[model samples]
Target: MLGILGLDELTERVYRELIHLGPSSVEALALRLSLDRDRVHRSVQMLEAKALASRNAVGQVQTAPPQLALGALLTAQRHALGQAELTAAALAEAYHSASTRSMHDLVEVAVGADQVRQRFEHIQLSAETELLALVQSTPEVVEPGQSFAEEEAVRRGVHYRVVIERPMLEEPGAMESVLGEVLGPERIRVVESVSTRVLIADRGTVMLPLTESPQVAEREGRRLDEVGEPMALVSRAPGLVTAMLGLFEYVWQRAVPVRLADDGLDAASADSAPTTLDLRILSLLLVGSTDAAIAKQLGLGLRTVQRRVAHMMELAGVTTRLQLGWQAHERGWLS
Candidate 1:
């Protein structure tokens, strides 16, 4: 029980023997503890230093009162703890400094769904400025009741911009729920396809899948989904994060804006008339500009260009890009 007071095993045993024997000599303690006399003498000297024991002028050892000795030990322990706390703080600062100096060291791999989710939640909670993501068709990462953290982040004025695959948004009531509870429709977009999943925060950190290729899975005679456990790579390298931000910008530009009914665009009017962005996209399309070229010409994102084109095609009741171009000309939309 008193080991917490910095007493070693032998010291505690000798101290206990001293208390039990009451003013016993080192020889008596050694005999009682079945320890060597020299070892008991050393323990007695240590106890004396702690003010727990004293040697009389006749050379016999005497123990201080239990209250006095225990109190002194407690005081010593508190002082040691204060010193340890200061040392720990200094060490933590040094470690943080060293970590900042090495960007490569900031990259980490998390395995298993739970670990990935935990890392994702940590990043979401820590985000202060902006969060950008491209979500593909994957297993759901956010479990029920866990979205409160994201809601808190949004309440703190953190901007969230997400581009989701169109098919994922097509789930029953998913779009409405996301718009109403998670993020506004203006900050979200949908794309026909996404190559990979990605998440970026404040242009400083990124998380992406760490998966094996189909060839490897085939060689192992395993289906893609059952090949191995899921993993994610998280990195805080400035250069790598910057490149990811560029990719997100390219995809965001080409994605179609998801306007809700309350945003002032009725289905009837949307089917008949084009939005300003849609008109710009039509003008670019009429000039024979590819999606990438249109995005570059108008300083829009590639995904935005593609999304507007798709929206225009839907409005014109055309099934193909070429047919939409012909419809635009026939309806005097090109003029």
Candidate 2:
């Protein structure tokens, strides 16, 4: 563990035993630790060079106080890390600026996985109201349950409106990440499929991927096959953002809210609007079509049609199809 502080294993062991033994000679340390005297002597010398150990006139080695010595080492490491962070931030800004043709434009295309990941995280941290996203399985920057910024945003009470493609939550670490303390089922809905990955922060800005990148491919150890580098289009352009927002809504309505905390229909069913398929099925039923007929017309399985009809009946608190139709009319479901 002390290797990170520049202490080799033997050196750290020697120092720790020195502290325990309290003023041990090299010979005594070697005999007690079953190490050669010369190796113990060398480690003690190294410890002394680092000011972590001292020898008395009689050549008995003793460790420096643990608190003082380790605190100094840790503080120096932290300072170095802080400097590196600043340098990295500068480098990242340069990378992003280089990728964009004009920083003044409302929309700019940026290359590199790092830039895209940074924006993905930065938007979460910057959100003050709602944050919306459609997540996919691959080309992931932030792994599931690893988005610290998202956890912070959730803690800030920012409402999340997120949709995950059906396969995404089945991927490894996906359930833990999306269902971890950072996110709950209440904020997430499942879609049959989503082709594009998107993020809309506060509905004011949208980020969309444009291509796979060599940087990401190499990082993931995948063959690039001469594929173009990963790139993302970020936009604050009102028309583009609005169109993206509309698309999000369209998909969101068709998606099914999920709940696995208990055995029952999704609690979201109480508040969520009827899905597009649900509306189409209800419409066909009201027009006096049989379940099989509706199924064939909608390209759904016959059993799927029956199941949906039963679910609608439950939602309407009625046991019969006729009552369900009457309830649908009362609720303005056709509209």
Candidate 3:
């Protein structure tokens, strides 16, 4: 029974013999059992480590005789182990809760950068449907391991969309190559603003750099790496995801659409850049503004706000209102 329970066979044998043979010195125990003195001493050491035996003043080992108290000691050990397990579980829950809380709720020192990256990676691998990203750095700076495995994942029907800043497209390296290869002019959208790094997966999870301008290219590669357990929270609350999606749409509507016209379109005000009216509509929506309020603020019909929001969702490739919010925030659509 002890063997089945993971006890070493030799330890079990030694323990049983000690129980049956009465308290004896190591030499006596070894001679009686026909085992090496060194082996007997080592087994005695193991028993001492577990508090199952003791050593006398002369450095001789003594096994505790089995008694009613032995059962109590075993029970105490089981209880202590149970308490340790529970404490560990509780701490894990607390850490996850702290990680998900907003910046307002964060009182502790900033977590290590590696910890944040690992958490983000966990979100990426577990994505079920779509991955909406607002990239602050080049793709090469994010996920350098753009291996065939990732290509295989996309081949298997993953919806991968990225809203990149203008500076990255104009610059060189993996960012330029990735944009040309994966996004291209037709597939990409440009948000012309200083961006915070954001990675959202399947609408269920999100990862972002806690810093205003994360040195993502210098520190972490393409993707925000994941930390801790796979399912653990990598950033602020899930509610923030809604805010970010709305913000992405807000930006997408105003952002200059990238086209495949052979010549890149020049960014100019004459091109009907987003005006103050667009900004007002975004502000209203971010504050949970109803269609009527948005229209009143922007001097448009209630139907207009609805139509624009719908169009924004289409541009961002999201379905529901909440997803739109997440997309918006991810793309720096809002302030």
TM-score of each: 0.47, 0.45, 0.37
lDDT of 3 by residue, 1-335 (tens): 45433357777777788777766788988998899999988888877776667877776666676564366567876888899999999999998887766454522232554455555555566666677767654432245334343444355566766666655443223233545444331244556553555666777556655443234434555444432222223444567777777766666666544432222322222223333344344544654557776575435688867766666667678898788767767776643
Best by TM-score: 1
Ranking by lDDT: 2, 1, 3
Candidate 2: list runs displaced more than 4 Å.
Answer: 1-105, 171-174, 213-223, 260-335
On residues 66-111, what C-alpha lDDT tens digit does candidate 1 reach at each position? 8978887798889999999999999999999888667557799888
Model 3 has an lDDT value of: 0.58
Report clash pairs, candidate 2: 145-177, 212-230, 213-229, 213-230, 214-229
TM-score ranking, best first: 1, 2, 3
Least accurate 10 contiguous residues by lDDT in model 2: 259-268
Where's the lowest-lDDT run of ten residues in candidate 3? 260-269
